[model samples]
Target: MPKLNIFVGTMYGGALDVAEQVKPLFEQAGFDVTIFEQPMLEDLIQHKTDVALFCVSTTGSGDFPGNFVPFVRAFHEQGPALSELRYGLIALGDSSYGETFCGAGRALDALLEDHGATRLGERLEIDAMETFMADDEAVPWVEQWIDSQQLKAA
Candidate 1:
């Protein structure tokens, strides 16, 4: 089975909830899914993750959540090459924040790309001002993502 790591970054649990909501979907699609509430760079390297999903919520002034800060710092400092990694991103933020909306997710996307990771599809950006539940948007997107990637049970 293909292994999939879901990295979650949240301040008020929205991103975590989104991750939980989508876990079973990935499993149903034949992916061995793991959700990391507090992600670490070592988790990626040690587990040899090839495919991943990032569910992150932008905090104050577009800052990363406290739990996610360490992973971001480690990734930036260590600068591991991720040419073999494929990823999808879900960014939660209120659009009212303007340019800073989903800032953390956008930054992470760029960072991952810079490190040679391939993005499987377009990033999902959930606007808090419009969606009451992020999963509503995330679930459909994930389903499509799985289909687009042609993921099947091993």
Candidate 2:
């Protein structure tokens, strides 16, 4: 059975809410899902899941949320290659921030790629400046991604 892990880095809790919204959908697809808020690097290093989904909100100046600092630091210091991991990212940002919009997500995605993880699909960037919330886009994206995964499996 393939396992799925959700790790969220949030300021003001919006990304966490989005992650919670998607948990059941992954479960319904037969993935054993585990969710974490601002997970530690050690936890990620030892994760048993085959797939990882990140729901992260960029903070001021496009920085990672405060709670993500330790994890990011540890990963840069000595994280091993995640050669067997498959991952996806849902970046929550306000497009009004201009170039820095979704910076944290892009940084994390780059880190994951540097560590050799395979991205499951295009990184989903949700604009908080839009009329709709991030989950609006995320929900449908997850549905489609799941459908594609199922098709590939078949």
What are the per-residue Cα lDDT tens digits for candidate 2 across 94-115?
9999999999999999999999
- Residue 17 Cα positional deviation in candidate 1, in Å, after optimal superposition: 0.4
What TM-score against the true fold does each predicted structure earn? 0.97, 0.94
lDDT of each: 0.93, 0.87
Evaluate model 1: give its lDDT. Answer: 0.93
Model 1 poorest ten-residue lDDT run: 42-51
Best by lDDT: 1
- lDDT score for residue 75 of model 2: 90
Count of steric clashes across candidates, in order: 0, 0
